[model samples]
Target: MKLNFLTLTPKATVIGLIMGLLIVFLGRGLGLFFFFMMLWFLVLSAIVSFIGKKYKLKRKLFEDTRGIKNVIANGLWPFLLVLAYYFLSSNQFLKYALIFAFIGSVAAITADKFGSEIGVLDGEPIMLLTLKRVKKGTSGAVTWLGISAGILAAFLQSLVMLPWIGYFGSAGISMLWLFVAAILGGLAGTLFDSILGYFEENGKGNKYTSNFFASVFGSIIALTIFLLLF
Candidate 1:
């Protein structure tokens, strides 16, 4: 996540901008705010993946340079929620809730990335549900280190919303509850991703599919919490 110009594939760059533009069309305020956040997200994600570069490379765990499909897989849910804000009832409650949902969506993926990038190096993984010792990269397997990393990553992502707390607080969004939703929503999404790894193991889906739905789950969980509180 160096601030330097990371070599984005031409197609990925095009797709990213197109998604960003569409988001702007849906909500200019949100669109503008997210543009910078998206950049920061990208930088952090890449750096997280690069943390144990030589180790990951030796173990075949290194992340490849993400391309267009990667962008779409990660970007689609946030965009859909933005479209929901644009097309659905325009009440402040819903809009504000969706804001947390957007954060949750991004946080989920970030959790996954951080968890994997850091946790994989722990060298001891077990089945997610059974606790049976399993090899690294085994779908549905997890490590304590990974789980903690995921939670920490999600919390980190939630904190990004702190600066906006007062601005939204004026709009009836409880800064405390909203922050809780963001963190829990993110955690649920990461857990869901791990659960879905079973389906991935059985060839029901791939990493992209899991990532996509985990993001959706994060939004759903965030929205639920918002509705309950507000």
Candidate 2:
């Protein structure tokens, strides 16, 4: 899919670039390996966004003007995790948890985005709670295609971080943990997003609010799992 950079609002574009640059710089300052990992993460996210736009997904957050807000909202958790990593790098006990948390956060957002964008293309979707057939793109509606896509997206997101796992000298064990954390976080985040979307669609809250909570919940779930295992 061709992504038209011109289609992005100037303000959003500027903000995204600034954020991207800052992340890269910070990541590099931490380590070259981390720099590449962060770059991979951003590149993958861009590709996903491109796919969503190419397919004409009805998600409002992907729109040019509103897309800026979506970027900031979704990027916040990962950004904070990176900052935490930087500050706590010297702390042996917390560094791995922070790294996994960051990975989990990205996985969650990636899965949710893929599921929502791809799921809506299915001919029919059923509400998660009711299991009744609902219109595609309807809040809380899910389809097999979307769920599969979500699972794949989460796995891919975690896979990209394998280098980080290798860097720590526990490739085999860390890989399994990262995969479990990412998949669980992704599924939980997507479900949380759907639940929040259901309320938002019913006039209980705005999309941004629901999305923010979903992101937070997704990250938390991943971090909790990491802590539990380690």
Candidate 3:
């Protein structure tokens, strides 16, 4: 039987394996970690694959697969926050904050990714600041359809963390808060990304730097909301 591993580059496969092991070692155990990892991987793959086919583009989706830098810039903070959650597992308060932060970070990045991939396809993008129509794929450009898709994507990504609610012993009352934090965080992150993109386009910074800052900003926003509400 052909294996799905064949489709991944050697480096990507290695990184996935390492991340799996790290998650298992971080107190999630093999079984639970594997389940979470599989679900996360599959969902992201489906999104990327759909966009790739729709755009008939091979390079954009696969760019991160070949290098460690993009993965670190876009994803490392969330993973570190996951590790922080485990480290603070003994402290219910801090653990809860970290958990929300982690989920928010992931949701933000997912929303941003969805916005970028799907948004570009919508014709006649408008600059977020000036409301002027810009070239398609122009930095800081947005559309109504794209923003709608991003909000929906954020909601879906938050739902993915539902299985952890029970595991973390979060009260049912807090469910709405989690979803709100995630959606808001996602929107905040995407806005940060667009702002940074505007600067990047004006020759202020590079894509990687903007993404890193956006992810960090999202995490902070999530943590802030959790602290305020609970």
C-alpha lDDT score of every prediction, in listed order: 0.76, 0.69, 0.67
Which residue runs does candidate 1 get wrong by more than 4 Å?
Answer: 1-7
Tens digits of per-residue lDDT, candidate 3, 122-193, equal: 778888877788886777788877787777777877776576667544353367787888888878887788
TM-score for all predictions?
0.90, 0.81, 0.81
lDDT, candidate 2, at 165: 60
Give per-residue CA lDDT, model 2, range 82-182, as digits (tens). 77777786776677777667767777777777787677666688888777887766777888888887888788777766656656555234577778888
Error at 221, model 3, angstroms: 1.9
lDDT of 2 at 6: 34
Error of 1 at 169 (Å): 1.5
- Poorest lDDT segment (10 consecutive residues) of candidate 2: 57-66
Ranking by lDDT: 1, 2, 3
Comparing 1 with 3 on lDDT, the higher-scoring candidate is 1
